[model samples]
Target chain A: MSESDRQGGEPEPEPERTSTGEYVLGGLGGLLVLLLLGFLIYQAAVVRDTGPELSVTVTGVETAGNGWSVHYRIANTGGQTAVQVQVTGVLSRDGTEVEESSATVDYVPPGSRRSGALLFSEDPGSGDLQVRPSGYSLP
Target chain B: MSATTDTEHLATGVGRAVGGALLFALPLFMTMEVWRLGHTVERYRLALLVLATVVLVIGLAHYFGAGPGGVSRAGYLADAGVALVVALLTASVVLVVLAVIDPVQDRQSALSVVVIEILPAAIGASYARSQLGAGSRRPQAPRYGHEVFLMAAGAVVFAANIAPTEEVVLLAAKLGERNAAVLVVLSLVLMHGFVYWVGFGGQEEATGFLRSFRNLTVVGYVAAFAVSAFLLWTFGRFDGVGLPVVVGQTVVLALPASVGAAAARLIL
Candidate 1:
């Protein structure tokens, strides 16, 4: 309807500003933020690729679903992220394996610990329960 | 210029840069690969990745304001440098907050991880104009150079989304040579069709298939391939891999990059 449209004109409704003043100020602020952030990062950390050199100790045992629940705590001694850490427990009486049970901890960071319970189908009152790390992947 | 306007504008650009840095690189920081990449990857490779990012940020400064230098090479480079610093700052802060870079336990590796994450984050910051800045750089008639830049920008944005993860490598490993080749063909067709459907500003009219093919399609594919190679190298997808593996990964990643490239011409 307007002359600009009829003539196929390029109409810029908002004036484009390419000012330098604001960028200078922003750049200074950004620099300060960077310095502060750098300082913080220099003092921060994350889980490293520490694997299954974990300490699995049986703290107690409780009776649960049709079996026994072996309570244990796993601590990562190695400096790596242990992903999908699975612990296997074998209940044996007189050197004969009775029931096998496994517990999984989604992730255990280096120098960190996770507590879980492994369920067994049979009672291990008369047997010695041996719990160890089955396997783990690096996170 | 009034003092008030100057301060306001300065805050605007800085805020956008920092916000853009944090927002755009969120996905990358969340990825486990990015967090530990610095520890496993070689030093020279990381340097190359940073260098490539610097080059991209230079061009990106045109749309995202780094200075008052309009269209000047130096200005773009300065803006890019600013983008890099902002991105680094943003990444450092977030890494610290998240405890991904544990300074007390492994300070060196944590710093390295932040540096690695900064690469993608800075690139994301360089794209603040498109992502956050509302009408900062008004679109004009697309030039050949501008079109190429847009394609590259799009490619970077798309490829960055997928490159840092192990999935790209896994998918590439699964794809056979024949399948990869077929996928490349499909990618080309999609790129060509995309441009036709969403015409880039100031695109020329070409009636014949050959003419259109030569103009937009070929150019887009070339840009896609170039972007793909750059992304693959940045993500360290090429180390200890043979030629087949490299090509397979590059092409697989290039599909989305090409589509992104085509979209860039039309969107910005």
Candidate 2:
């Protein structure tokens, strides 16, 4: 395919030629395109569109700076993506709400997980801790 | 020796296609916004996007493809088919290596991610096959309509490279009306400069300033804006935004896209 292989000062049309390798690669490529497109079509036909379903679980609590940080993992299990997800953590001491901390996750894609932390002056370990998704906007 | 050489030529063409896929699509593969978009984008939309990509790739291959069997109707078709395969396979491998998808567990997600990536990768493959391969063939001059389409394709590449990130939306939110208007003028000036003054290979014909600006640069920016809006919508960037934000984001993305459009004229 190099330019030097062709002769003369003017550009002569190269004779048509094909090798076994070209046929093999080309055939394989064609087959793959058909299969991939078919699969996507199948998915589009069968899957139902759904909105984002979000859930938050507290993973751990640690001392961060002057406060205790409540680390949480947020997951979206539905079809859509959740943007600006708000996760709120409440630490209650003896049935009284002592501290409320919340964090905002940028986005949580369906079937994916994102982690964030909330800080509170009172240690979550000293009280009954409850973490839940407050709200989220759709993308 | 001739047979071996032909086989080597095919191999080199395939190799360049692979390299081109990476060259164009690596940014999107690494972007977190795109990875999220894979699962979030509607299934039918993703499927439709695949079909659109197929059509665009075939058109591009007609101009840039080496056509291993010869530059005939069947030759470019074969080239387009191979470019699609190379693009898909290359995207799959790279996304997997980057842990962008877990094929076994995130099966639905993996499919969507690959589908989204296919367009840019396929275009890159076709471009590489035609332009970078040994004994590259010079394509015939593109018609006016084809020129606009090339600009749109270039816009897609540049816009896709950046649209998935949060910065577009954030930048739009902050750009305000005055800055956005300034951005529009800046994009036009930059596009015009690249096409006429930069002296890039295959520069636009130096028609009189007003005529060239009116015909090519202005039209190209409009095409870039439309392409940008489509891209942002595909990534769900327009889903929950106000009208002003939508317009602002479109203008922001049109900046890179207009540059790409101008570059396509010079390169493609």
Best candidate (score: TM-score): 2
lDDT of each: 0.69, 0.82
Cα error, residue B31 of model 1, in Å, equals 1.4
Report the first chain's TM-score for all candidates.
0.63, 0.78
TM-score of 1: 0.65
lDDT of 1 by residue, B180-248 (tens): 989989988887777675455634455688877777677878888887887678667887799999998
Model 1, A1-139: lDDT tens digits are 2456634765443433445653463365345434544443443334343344877999998899687888989877775557788899999998998889998887665556778998887786778899998888864
Clashing pairs in model 2? none
* Tens-digit lDDT track of model 2 for B157-250: 8988888889999999899799999999999999999989988777666779998899889999999999899888888888877899999999
- Give the distance in Å from residue B152's predicted Cα in candidate 2 to where it truly belongs: 1.6
